[model samples]
Target chain A: MNAALSWLESLLVLAGLLSPLMLPMLYFLLYRPKRRDGLASPIDSLDARAARPSFFQRWHCGLKVACLLATCFLFISPRGLAVCLADVAIALLATALSRPSWRRVLARLAAMSGFLTMLLLMLPFSGAVQAGEPTYSLAFLPDSLPLRLSGLGAATLIILKATAVALLMEPMLSTATLADTLHGFRQLGVPASLTQMLLLCHRYIFVFQHEAARMWRGMRLRGFVAGANAASLFAIGNFLGMLFVRSFERTQRVYEAMLCRGFTGEMPRAAAPPMTARDALKALFWLALAVSPLVTEMYFADFMRFLGE
Target chain B: MHISDGVLPISVSVAAYVAAGAGVAVSLRFLRPEDLPKIAVVTSAFFVASLISVPMGPTSVHLLLPGIVGILLGPAAFLSIAVGLILQCFLFQFGGITALGVNALMMGVPALVCAGLFRWLQNGDRRRAMCSGALVGGLGTALAACFLALFLATAGENFFAAAKLALVAHAPVVILEAVVTAAMTGFLFRVKPELLCLPPRSKWRGKGDCSL
Candidate 1:
């Protein structure tokens, strides 16, 4: 069962940790969300426009992506090397289709290679033991070392997997997941009020994050630091105080706004992304792919028994 | 405080899944159509009033504001906590899958109680209520620990030994958390009393009009 999970979980953790990097990559590669979406979007809809890269853009994107994939493969060590190869194929296809300048491609490729070499040399992920030995360690990191190649490999893989999960799965899952959760509550006969409360709370979270950021920044400019004692302490107290007052006032405004718009008990809806056969098939395919590693481990790979414990 | 997937027993996990549903059911009845705006407002209040974390040994634990939620929103706090927990889990993995329900209950039920306490303390110096909140917060943590201990105990675990180890180890951590919670709540009272509820119709008005 861990076959898919091992990779997926690690990937998610990686994505969560390296969100800053993965977010930009995802933005470049995927469909850009826009102002029109805001009517339906619960979060703030700022101009999420990205300056489109030109012909060179595609190649550079592809090249950079391939390099990321290489690093990811070197780290996660997905049970079947096939997935890594598939990613490589995808990267190559993307690069080919993108058709960047050859000179730039060569340079980027060299840079990619150099990055991996430096990562490999500077970070340790290698060890004396053979693969599938049931090495019980955090990503099988050893007791003593500057940087274990195996550990580095595992760490990188974990992060890469997270990025992949975040990029590939997040958009599809978020709304559906929210809906599913709401659906589950409704089925249980949870009151609409409670359900609505849940939804509103979720909606307001973005507002909190946004406001908190702005408030914190304003506070900082006015001399608020989390660590400093006298100045920082007083500033934090004042900043927090102001944040409270502002938050209180903001909610009232937001509430009044919602009321004016006829926010009934039900959450506003647009057409949900339709569930399709492709989605079903893809889901099944992924399940099988993820499960395969566990099946393999059942027979030839007792390695995890030692490794997991 | 968020326990991970493999941390709890199968029974505990299963029971929690069921209980999480039950918690939702219990709170659902009081919600009204007009409540949406207030829900929005209170929720907005929750977002701010909730932050201002207190520093503990290595980590910082903030005010859960469970009591405030319980008082204002009532059982709706269950859903609020649920949504908040889900976001926190997805965004930061603060509390992993297995511990999600327990974590929710730990923070949720207390807020439910805090709502009641809010009424009790509204009149006399409201600042003291924050102190009560700070203290009761520890009770919530203790209850969570006990539930977790019971979970391990029923599974043939050395619950006492484990509790001793965990509680002893985490005592300073807990107090540090409590102190910070208290201090932050204190700040909330002085700063954003509106977050707890609406600002008095006028802040400058005398205390006679400030009655809860």
Candidate 2:
């Protein structure tokens, strides 16, 4: 088989890499964040802020997700590609169902575009050469169409795989609040100590950002301007050190308060409700749907060959 | 350099995840229970640090400070990086969940190595500490860039250009982090010398609390 990608695949790779640039506009056009109240939303109030799912409901969705991700990892053929695309479509549907803020999707797409671009640029040009084959070099007139086409294929595969998986995360992550998700993970058997630590760390990122900003303002008021020099470097160093010292002191105080409240290494968590038969069935259904493509692809490979003939 | 999802083959991504998982497990094991809050604080600091970019020539690069994390947090640095990476994934989507393990490994392993090197070289000399601080900072970023390249190259021969470009792009960051880590460590050495010590460990560990 020629290792290079076809022009169609190359175009798909490029499109996948660059498509996210339009996501922000799409998001704004499709989902507006503002209400008549004029209050800016951190996340959508509809699905994200609504009633939390039961432990069973959450796990059901979790199982479906696990199956979806596994299928994505397993299958790499055209049928497998269709399955991933289907999964992405379902995930996007779920995100729309949740009425999540367009900002979140926009951010996810924006975040992914850089890595996608890098992959698109690199994967196509780095073709592996077989014995007696022409070396694939970057030139105005290329010698190896096979190499270029294969490269395009590799790039497309990467872009598609990444895009599918990333799109799946939109619903999983943005559909619920962080607290609920953490609780879901806790229910799923992640250590409470770690989850608590994650929550604490997450919460403080905002707090410390504010503190750091105030400190930066203080530095600027004192005529500090960061530059590529020793003085500025040292000043920034002192600023970070100061931030650390203050944070450490704050940690001490917080720890003491927690200790006073009988805090153990791990925070106490409520036990999750037991799963029901319906939950199992729901999970099973989604799992079936998720893996259906793989099952069909495997069983139908011979049939596909026969059809091609 | 966040690897992003779908770049590396499943085999490579899985391998990176396993390696990163091992690192995180070891980090968790060595982490003292009492220092959970402290780790959280440092993790937040590291998270915020990555957001603040400093101007370098015509372009600006964000602070990574993996060296600083390794130096201060010691064995716990890997866990710290993992935590920071998770938040970055969720909040900023800086890296995808699929690539989380690889990104963590790229940043965390270098942190572990550099932290160890920094400690060994400093050996309580002020001059050595300053030089070692700078060296580890640069070395950490360089090592991370190398790891990033390695991960990208895992896709096959087709990604060498991408790998090279990625590595070259980080050169300025390498220098920047080196200077920043050096200055930060020196400043911490002078004031609150205890903060420079490898964070307290849970296991039977060395008692060099004030080594720097």
Per-candidate DockQ versus the true complex?
Answer: 0.18, 0.48
**Over the stretch A1-309, how does candidate 2's per-residue lDDT look in tens digits?**
333445676566556546645655575576664421111123222235434443222554444345444544543234445555665665565556555555666667766776776666656556565556443333232555333555666676666666666665555555545555666655555566676778888878877877887788777788877777777777776777788878878888988998999988876655545656876786677567656656767788799889999
Looking at model 1 chain A, report the run of 10 residues with the lowest lDDT sum: A37-46
For model 1, how does the per-residue alpha-carbon lDDT over B1-212 read when each residue is reduced to its tens digit?
Answer: 44433234446655775788678565544555665545554555555445455444355445454544554454466666765665554433444444467667666766666555554555435566457645654554554455555553442322244434444544654454344445545666665443444223334334321211
TM-score of 2: 0.82
Against the unseen true structure, what C-alpha lDDT does each candidate score? 0.45, 0.69
In model 2, how large is the Cα lDDT of residue B171?
A: 93
Q: List clash counts for every candidate, in order.
A: 20, 7
Q: Predicted chain A of model 1: TM-score relative to the true chain A?
A: 0.39
For B82-199, candidate 2 gives per-residue lDDT tens digits of: 8899888866667777778889999999998987887677556556666888898899999999999898877778888889999999998888888888888877777766776633
User: Which candidate leads the pack in DockQ?
Assistant: 2
Candidate 2 deviant stretches above 4 angstroms:
A1-81, A129-147, A177-180, A186-189, A227-230, A300-309, B198-212
Residue-by-residue lDDT tens digits, candidate 1, A1-309: 012224455455344433334433454345343422101112321111112342222222222223332332232334434443443443344444333333323322221232233223323324344455333223322343223335445434423333232222122212233544454345445565655665666666667656666776666676644642333434443454555456556765777787788866577654434545654554454345434444655564666566777
